[model samples]
Target: MTKDEFLQFLRDPDVCKEIFEIVKKGGKPAVVAPQVQPQQKFSSIADKLKTVYPNANAPQIQPQPAPQIQPTPQPAQPPKNNAPKGSGSLADKLKFLRGHLDKVREEEQIAAAKAQEKSPAEKYTVISNRRCPICEKDTRVVKTKSRINVEKRDLDYCIHYKDFDPYLYTVLTCEHCGFAAEEKKFSGAWPNKLKETLREFLKQNDMKFPFVEERNAEDALSLFELAILFSEMTDQSKGRQAILNLNAAWVCRCEGFADRERDFMEQAAVDFEVALENERWPINGISDDMATYLCAAIYFLINEYDKSTTWLGRIMNNANLRATAPKLFEQARDMWQDIKRANKA
Candidate 1:
């Protein structure tokens, strides 16, 4: 039976008692088996008794007493003039104000805690043998200390300090060789002066220094180093800028617009090829190898098929790089295959 019908049957005490008796005797109710026709509705006490005692032949049904129903009294209406106006009662207003005050106090505590946790200025030691700018002695090497202005809104002065203000500057002197150099304190922006210094260093060295190459190559390498240092120093903004600079260099390499683009390409190919000699296509992180793939793609686009195939093979063989950039690697593979097929044809 449906739940509603069963519930209605339960509401009737006579029907419930009859069903219980049938269950006690291990007999199915008459309503459940329609093959045995019922003379009257099971809800009726006489019908229920006959159904319960089917073999009794002279069963008498006693009517069950109905439950007494108490009459409900209506409440008296409240007077409209007795109600107070203005939003709500004073108790509710005070409770709301208390909650708001608590929230404010909690926020203030958090702000205060964060303020208290402010990091002291990072100290960087100048390790190179460059002459001391101040003492002129070769043994004045010391640790330079400078605080990062975390609240600086401008991007220019946020990463590294461009201006050489001595107050913001932290000087370190070396004890051994007495080599000293001024490192501009970093906030969030790349120091303008340091970038200028790097640019000048590139120019003075004719871009042929140990780590320097073409413009993009030098920029990429320098930025990558800076990013690594900043990341280690807990300077996230500077680290992010370095990554952006690296990505820009990659784009410039792909577009062939960067100064010394061809030189950078040749150098990069050589680096990757050398890395492949060790059976490690990446030799770095996955993202770094992905940049290598872009370099390979540029070579492929320029009809340097041999170099393209070499780099593409490296990507295909490297399990980590392959997993990270599967789709890009697959495209490179298909392109390489097509080029080979064309050559054979």
Candidate 2:
């Protein structure tokens, strides 16, 4: 109420006793309903407490606002991702970007390595248009600019190369009609009768060509075999067929196909004898003397010593061989000596 009224009430013994009980309770200070007193009258709180508890031995009870139990000061927690700006989202974004950049770099390295690994033969080839006689379609003819190093030339005309072999690409494959032949024959003139036979043969079968540009040893051999089939239907010279088979056999040897190599060599031998008897001399760039020599070489290679010696005897006995072609005579003489030695051994 009024300050004068409050002072009169504090003077009463029961009110003063109640306030004293609250202040004297155990533990920290206990708060009671605060009675407003005039500042001028209640200047010293100790004087009032002493006045209230007069004669009894009372503990000094000073008026104090209740002790404020402030919550404990806790240290701030760091972000789980250890972000600079204390944000996990920014850290996650940076991690994703770094991973993406690494993947990009890996793909680029693979691309560069593939480019570097391209074939060496691609640089030395000359591309020219060649018309296929069988199919009447255009096939690209790829030939080497020049011959590579000649390591050795064998009797059956297989020239071993110290570098890339152009013989592997000698066969021109027509992608349209599956007609494959040597670069010269593939583009050269063909008889109308042979063309008609091939046309009839093509009508009965389905064939597709699936190669271009670069060819592995295996694919080139496959093309050679395909050309052999096409060669038979086209009435290509037996000598020419024998040469094709010999070249294919050489390729087989290089590729480690021993069984197929021997088989082709045997076919070449049979065809060579037929070509010599039935066809004319200088057949398919091979002279009659050369054909006889190849027949001997083929028989020798296949271990047909009887046929080999019989064919070799012809070249050895021919009186005009030394005068016309001394090199053939020399090779023939050397081969005969070798065959006699082989048979004796």
Candidate 1 lDDT over 211-239, as tens digits, reads 21112334434433443333333423322
Candidate that scores best on lDDT? 2
Q: Estimate candidate 2's RMSD in Å.
A: 19.6
Taking all chains together, the TM-score of candidate 2 against the true structure is: 0.64
Q: Looking at candidate 2, what is the lDDT of residue 216? A: 68
| Candidate 2, position 108, lDDT | 100
Q: Pick the TM-score winner.
A: 2
Model 2 C-alpha lDDT per residue in residues 1-345, reported as the tens digit of each score: 589867976776654655667655632233332454565364354446545444323454677998999899879977664333533355576986788789999999999999987364775667777777877888776677684777888767788777667767878777777777887687678889988888778767765566477666777788788778887777767888888888888887767789999998998998999988898878557799998999999998888889999999999899999999999999989888888899899
Evaluated at residue 71, the lDDT of candidate 2 is 95
Which 10 consecutive residues of model 1 have the lowest summed lDDT?
151-160
The 0-to-1 C-alpha lDDT of every candidate, in the order given, reads 0.46, 0.77
lDDT for model 1, please. 0.46
Count backbone overlaps in model 1.
22
